[model samples]
Target: MDLMQWYQKAMSSDAYLEYMKENKERTASILEKFSIPEEDRELLERIGEHSLKVIAITEDWCGDAMVNIPILLKLAEAANIEVKMILRDENLELMDQYLTNGTSRSIPIFIFIDEEGKERMVWGPRAPLVKKVVDDENAKLPPRDHEDFPLRKKEMIQRLGNLYSTDRTIWQEVYDSLKTSLVQSILM
Candidate 1:
């Protein structure tokens, strides 16, 4: 099924609606905190003018998905950019192509593509910075209980902890970097 269908189906679920309602205030606060600046607002206009397509993979049951998806949707709305949401497990082929490290099925992977269908910027729950920390050679990381996916809950918690600990600085960096990248991609 297409992304719209997936989104409709997911929204139809009571659990999904409940999740959104429960986190509405927190989500709004985060969006307000991360408001794009005037300079970046022009970049957002460029992103909208380019009319790039954004494919987002997410699931309702996921906490990270719940948090990030709302932020993404709000960003798209503010920028007037088009977006499509899809469930990860429901679409294996697309997921396989974009899945990191050939295994992780993390959600809210935002895939940005230009008019000609060329990929430009991709961002979401798992950023490269976090991945590097998770895979550090010198660091002793916890093992995954499930053989299928190593570093599930443990890594997720660690990532969340790291995020909370350094949210202000890291979020600013990520926002600026992403804005610059998106602007450059569309302008180029």
Candidate 2:
């Protein structure tokens, strides 16, 4: 099927918003707290003129999705871009094409497309800075075979979740990364 067909079959932004209301409290929280920075507002407006759309391959349960999707939604709103959400597990056909490291089936991949449904850029899973922060945290974990590993891992996930929810610096990093990519793809 063509890209438009895929987009037509996917969940609309309204439908995705309704779907999130059921169990995506974290995502909802992030949306409530996040906003496009004033300096970035004009950039989004400029992007809006292109009439772009994005397909977000994701699921509600992913912590990365919980953090990143809201930012995308906000940008989409300001930029007047449309978004269709395709559940990764249900749409492995598309998800497989954008795997993290060509191996992991990571959620929250954003595929930006123009009005003609031509792919412009792909972004996802985590920003470079975000990945570094996550990797550094993971590096401190004990070996899997160690007795403290399980507890440490669990605690680490909890801490990251907490940080993702409350830290505006991380949110700004996410915005900066996406802005850079969008500028390269649409402006420069």
Q: How close is candidate 2 to the true structure, as a TM-score?
A: 0.93
Q: How well does candidate 1 score on lDDT at residue 187?
A: 76
Report, for every candidate in turn, its global Cα lDDT versus the true structure. 0.58, 0.87
Q: Write the per-residue lDDT of candidate 1 for residues 106-172, one digit (tens) a residue.
A: 6667777666556778776644554454346215544544463455555655565446333655445
Q: Which stretches of candidate 1 lie over 4 Å from their true place?
A: 1-28, 61-67, 114-121, 132-140, 144-166
State every prediction's TM-score relative to the real structure: 0.65, 0.93
- Predicted candidate 2 versus true structure: per-residue lDDT over 1-188, tens digit per residue: 66776787899866886787433777788899998888878989998899888999988778888889889999999899999988899988988889999999987899998888888889988988989999999999999999999999999989988888889888888888888899999998
Best by lDDT: 2
**Candidate 2, pairs of clashing residues:** none
